[model samples]
Target: MEILIPLTASLVLLLIGYFIGTILEKKHYQSINDREEKFINLPSVTMTYRAASKETDMSKYSKTQLVSGGVVVSIDYFKRFLALLRNFFGGRVSSYETLVDRARREAILRMKEQSSGADMIINVRLETSTISSSAGDSETVDSIEAFAYGTALYK
Candidate 1:
């Protein structure tokens, strides 16, 4: 009887977290999709642009600037619990996958927004890191951050 109330309470909290997280994630994904479509025409140039930037005809471009974007996304408590279980069983942690995907995509979108009028973005790169808290002897994962950076050329 004593364990029943606590167990039921924990289950309720987990369900609440899951539903809220799902809704929020869906909204964010929709936003990402829309923004991606909005910037679909923007070309992400590679090393070729890097070489072009150094050409003698630099006057062709009105501006060349560096653009970057980064965001930190946190997982809901329910996801944390699932990740813990996955760790115990030793398999792929799928929840973390979405967290990372969301972060990376959001970062790229933001970078694109920064270079809205640029003809092309060149030498793009992405980096990710885990945000965690360490107090005394305990460490806990809090969030993950994704950063995107590139050079933009305005013509």
Candidate 2:
């Protein structure tokens, strides 16, 4: 009876965490999609340093400046728990994929928002880093930081 009590308690907690995490993740993704759509027409973003040869027209822009955006995202308890189990299997950590994708997209949207006055953003770059947190005696990756930067040209 004693063993069953602890096991049941653990299972209940895990179930609660999973449901809450799923809801929060879906909500965040919905918000991201809405914001992305809002900024879809802001400016053209590209990783290439220069536009295609035929499209290059330096005379169109009168000013250029650097624009950047950064975001920090953390995984919920359910995702962290899933990741811990995946670590033992030595396979891709699928739980972290959505977290990383969200951070990256949010960063890019913020960069575009910051450069709303620009005609286009070129030479775009993205960077990501893991943030660690102390859990009792050990440190674990608790969140991720994403940064996006680019050069904005204004007409």
lDDT of each: 0.88, 0.85
Instruction: Write the residue-wise lDDT of candidate 2 on 7-113 in tens digits.
Output: 88878877887898889889989989999898777665565655532477778789988999999999877788899999898799999999999999999988988
Could you tell me every candidate's TM-score relative to the true structure?
A: 0.89, 0.85
lDDT of 1: 0.88
Compared with the true structure, what per-residue lDDT tens digits does model 1 show for residues 34-114? 999999999765555648658536578888899999999999879988998999999999988999999999999999999
Deviating ranges (above 4 Å) for candidate 2: 1-9, 47-54, 134-136, 139-141
Taking all chains together, the TM-score of candidate 1 against the true structure is 0.89
lDDT of 1 at 105: 95
* Candidate 2 TM-score, C-alpha based: 0.85
lDDT of 2 at 120: 81
Clashes of 2: 0
